[model samples]
Target chain A: MPINYYIILSLTLFVIGIVGVLTRRNTIIVFMCIEIMLNAVNLLLVAFSKMHHINQVATNPTAGTEAQLFVFFIMVVAAAEVSVGLAIIVMLFRNTHSIDVNFLNRLKH
Target chain B: MTIIQILFWLLSALVLLSAIMVVINRHPVYSVIWLIITFFGISGHYILLNAQFLAVVNIIVYAGAIMVLFLFVIMLMNLNKDMEPQKSKWLKLVGAIACGCLLLVLIAALKDIDINNQIAETNTGNIGLIENLGTVLFTKYVIPFEISSILFLSAMIGAVVIGKKD
Candidate 1:
């Protein structure tokens, strides 16, 4: 399979997520954008690793699974991120009664 | 383009489109749903890449577990509040400029590689054989593997501490 489509899609999705992170006032949307970015990078990494497995190298079957390994780490980290991030979001929501991120500008010293 | 290539292109389009919608959608629920669709499309990309184990894991962790938590957060929070900040026109302009700059950089970097010129082998569902993944992870990545659990533990503690209200 050509990796072009995967790369382009991942890049586009990542760009959009970055834009959302910067533009969206809602903190929930920012968190979602972060997820989107993570997913995009995961997709790209998997695609490239698969591409390497297909060409030049004889698909070591053993060595080529590194990307998949990282994907596992990515999942674990993302899981931890959600637990902590959402817990913070929930706390912020209780105190402020809103999920808007811009209002979190308390560091204006 | 061949049939598979055509299918890849189609799914890629769907993924990018849904991702855009996820960012632009006003309703919180709808945005999350678009994000789910985007994950499904990523899984399809995974299948194309012959990463069967990764594809399933992607769906399970990202599309399933993480998204459920995201939706839970959305539901737990009240949207109707006076404190919700609205985006100003200047910030929107700045965001657009940043996105455009990123697009230009991506295109510039990717232009050298012609994807069609490369002939990719057809290997499916065999890349992540359980033995293969287990050996490499156990041997090469042992430290990171051990360290990640600690990271998760700390994150758990942090969540508890920060979330506690006095």
Candidate 2:
């Protein structure tokens, strides 16, 4: 498959994520959108890894291995992020009784 | 077009549609469901690209574990109702337009890149296999791997601290 197609597809997915983050009032939905954006970047990274592999397979058999490992680490970090973020969201809801992003405008409460 | 090409397009359509649905759905539960679909579609793309390890990991981590956590939180918070207040029409329009413009700019900037002729190796790459990746992970990337474990530990402790009621 052409790398351009993957790039365009990933870009569209990322844009959709941005739209979700910008338009949604629900904090959980916004967090989900962030996950979507992360997935889009992961897909692009894997695609690029394959592209690099195809180009350099002659000299290096494991040409694109680093990118895939990077994706693995990304998943690790995202998991940790989600745990902490959701805990914060739950705490916010416990105090504010709502999960609206607008409710969080003021840092001083 | 080859079978691989057809499969790629199909997966791409599935991913994009489900991602949009994740944004459009009013109920957070439905959004979570749609996000799972989106993750599955991306996993299909990974399989197509022959990154078997990442595909399996994506499904297990994103679709299975992470999404379950999301659902648990949503249900615990009793957020199944459509209680999300709608943004103003103008604000939504502006957001959509901004995203569209960003997409256009990115496409324009990347359309004529030098990688136009390059192709991603699909259905035939040993580098994506688990054995090779495991060796590289334990050898070249061992330190970062250990650091990520510490990161997970800190995150766990932070969650516990923040989530504990006063």
Candidate 3:
């Protein structure tokens, strides 16, 4: 398969994630959408890394693979972020007994 | 189709399908389960890209650690499927239109970009062994790398403070 295939796939996934985040009232699903966007970008970065490696455009694969390293760090941070985010959401649910953002009316001025 | 290509397609399909389930499923437990599958599929993609270290880290961090926390929270709160509220039709339409436009723009912009028609020439001999990864992590990018750990430590502290009893 062409590497562009992965790019297009990544684009599609990103859009789906955007749609989810825009429409979903549930905080957990919204968090999942954010994760989706992160993964889509990781795929795109890896695709570009392969492109750079294949065309011999970059002299050092090590440098080119920096994108992959960046992605690894992103994943680590994402894991950390999601755990905390989920905890906060759970805490909110314990008090409010609901997950919908629209009904979070107590914060309204 | 050759074996490797076929495997790639299969893994991609699994990932995409599980991701869809994560969005649409009503039960939070089911949704979390689907997310685990999604993590597994992403790890498979990492392997296909010849990043064995990345694949392992993905599984360890996401599937093993992060997901355990997700499940813990899900169970701690005892979320019910019936508690999930329905979004309005208008919001759905707005989201779909926004996403559709975004997808169209991305596809249009990428039309002229061709990449990796040929497989990358990788030194599969070493294939980024752990020693190589460690060398780069500690030597060249050591400062930023260590700084990121400090960042993570701060995040962990913040999470603890935020999550303390009210």
Model 1 lDDT per residue over B1-166, tens place: 7777887888888888898898888788888899999989888877776777777888898888888988887776745444456688898889989898997899779867767455344355355656677788899999999999899899989999988887
Q: What's the TM-score of every candidate structure?
A: 0.89, 0.98, 0.90
Chain A: TM-score in each candidate?
A: 0.89, 0.97, 0.87
On a 0 to 1 DockQ scale, where is model 2?
Answer: 0.93
Predicted structure with the largest lDDT when compared to the true one: 2
DockQ scores for all predicted structures: 0.66, 0.93, 0.53
> Which residues of candidate 1, in runs, are more than 4 Å off?
A59-61, B80-84, B113-125
Clashing pairs in 1: none
Over A1-109, each residue of candidate 2 has an lDDT whose tens digit, in order, gives 9999999999999999999999999999999999999999999999999999999989998899999999999999999999999999999999988998987887866
Winner on lDDT (1 vs 3): 1
Chain A TM-score (model 1):
0.89
Docking class of 3: medium
Residue pairs with clashing backbones, model 3: none
Alpha-carbon error at B121 in model 1, in Å? Answer: 4.5
- Give per-residue CA lDDT, model 3, range B1-166, as digits (tens): 7676787789878888888788778787887898889888877777777777777887898788877887887788777877778788888888788889989988998887554354543324223346656777778788878887887887788778777778
Could you give the candidate ranking by DockQ, starting with the highest? Answer: 2, 1, 3
| Poorly placed runs, candidate 2 (over 4 Å) | none
